[model samples]
Target: MNKEISIQLSNVSKTFRTSSKSFSTLRDRLINFYKKNEVKTIKALKEINLEIHAGETIGVIGRNGSGKSTLTKIMSGTFIPDRGGQVIKNGTSLLLNLGVGFSHELTARENIYVNGSTLGLRISEIDELFYEILEFSELEDFKDTKIKYFSSGMIQRLSFSIAIFAKADIIFLDEVFAVGDNKFRKKATEALKQNWLKNRTSIIVSHSTGVIKEHCDRTILLHKGELIFFGETEKALAMYEELE
Candidate 1:
């Protein structure tokens, strides 16, 4: 049977240009005002091609500065690839990384409405699920609290709750397990197994080999800003361990 392609990337790449000159003080800034700072290019992702099937759980693993986050951002439409690169998505996608996409100055309740609306939920729908989102996040006490005051765990839980309840078609989990406590991590893991994996396309980026081995059917191994391997979970883990 042929599976539907949820995401397709063709010649996708990202590069960042940075200036070498730094101005530490007003005098330094004035001195460099007319001078052109030498610009350097860093290729965060080399031209990479991939096709992810709908309802598949893909894992991305790599050491620091290995372009893992960059790749996910591109896939989730947070970052645009250079010219001649292409990314095609079959459905609405959401990137769940480190409590991003939330306004910290707003109350948790307000952010929930905003986020839920972004996920295509009507205001009435968000109103209905508002309490459930708070309850699931174990953040009932902080519903009215400003998000800036919430702990990382609290923010992560709230973010995850909103994504799950919002039913995003493609979810990119970027090191999300790194923030929450053990108890909440367990709950989140279980929720992923029960809810997200059943019918959605998911890309999980984690440092834990156990997580990739347990949850991913296939994994992509990235090294030094390049995708070196994309295949069986065990094989990718073996290559990652060798790099480590």
Candidate 2:
């Protein structure tokens, strides 16, 4: 039997508008007020079509500025595609990237409550999972410390631990293995292999071909804001290697 379609994107594209004008002072700002702002439109993603199947682990590889992150955001509903685009998602999704869903002003303890609540857990449930989250993140000592003081690896570890316990149906992991120390990376990889990704649909966005090759059955290669290749993991990696 065919696998269920977990996500489908048709004619999906994203464009960003940026201003080129720079104001160095109040007078500079005022001088440019009457002039039309020089706006540049950059296509972050072109018309892309893709179908991701349920329970499949997919890898996305690309060079910088290749729209890998944009594609994941669109799938996770964090970014809306341009007009005439459609996104069909079949499950509750969570997007995991470095410090994306965290509040720098809040302590780790406070963030647990906030993030857990956002994930549909009640106060009591959060209380129950609170210790577990901290333990898994190996951040029990810094629970009351403010997030801004934490290192990037600490933040990513905390973010990932929460997602695992919350049991999100679809997970978009963006460069998860990049920031942390080797020990944590090994631990996280083991957890994914042993428990986390079982029967779950996940999209891993990473520059590491080894991670992609080991985890993903299929992979997609993006270049210059376009979906250039999608097929077997080895084939996609080969194409990405040539591009690099």
Candidate 3:
């Protein structure tokens, strides 16, 4: 427990119990369930020991399915670790997956208020930021259109815009995969640099080595749910390349 640590994981291990039956049939489940129901525990995090300090941009990078999202969930308090524990010392909002809250029937404008407030914005705050979100999303013309008419890229762009509107001590972003076009992606990236990078504890999980090299001060490498390296960005990236 370092004094400056905003997030800490000490020997933290997270496991999930899954059943073989898939809840299909009682007979099949009972027949095959003689072996104690065949419950399998999947370890999503293994003996993770790390610390995140204030005003640090840390990148959590690894291949797909390397438990990056799981780790984000734990930090967001959406999932509790099974064995050893984790602690978050600041307010954290995770934009790990996009489109988790937008209703298809609702207009993009409506979703802004609903979704933005869900991220902890006050109604007045959302009202003040509505135009900004629409502007940043590049969806002004589509503001009245239902989200069902929006493309995946548009949805992500909108979600990203909304996620950063409300102030938080810490934020976790899971890749910039669906930010419309390259131009829009660059816009979002610059917004992140100009806005989120200042006076915030941010964790970004990205596959882009260039992004890690360019932005992160510290990097952590994960392989098959196990933490392999935690140190300076360059050193951890070297480990990532060797593992790859």
Q: What TM-score would every model get versus the actual structure?
A: 0.92, 0.91, 0.90
Lowest-sum lDDT 10-residue window in model 1: 19-28
Clash pairs (backbone) in predicted model 3: none
Candidates, ranked, lDDT: 1, 2, 3
- Candidate 3 per-residue lDDT over residues 27-138, each given as its tens digit: 7766765566667889888878888887888899988878998888787778887754755556555554666778989999899988887778899988888888999988
TM-score of 3: 0.90
On lDDT, the leading prediction is 1
lDDT of 3: 0.81
Candidate 1 lDDT over residue span 55-94, tens digit each: 9999999999999999999999989999999999999888
Residue 63, candidate 3: C-alpha displacement in angstroms: 1.9
Compute the lDDT for candidate 1.
Answer: 0.89
User: Which candidate leads the pack in TM-score?
Assistant: 1
The regions of model 1 sitting more than 4 angstroms off are: 20-34
Q: How close is candidate 1 to the true structure, as a TM-score?
A: 0.92
| Angstrom error at residue 6, model 3 | 1.1
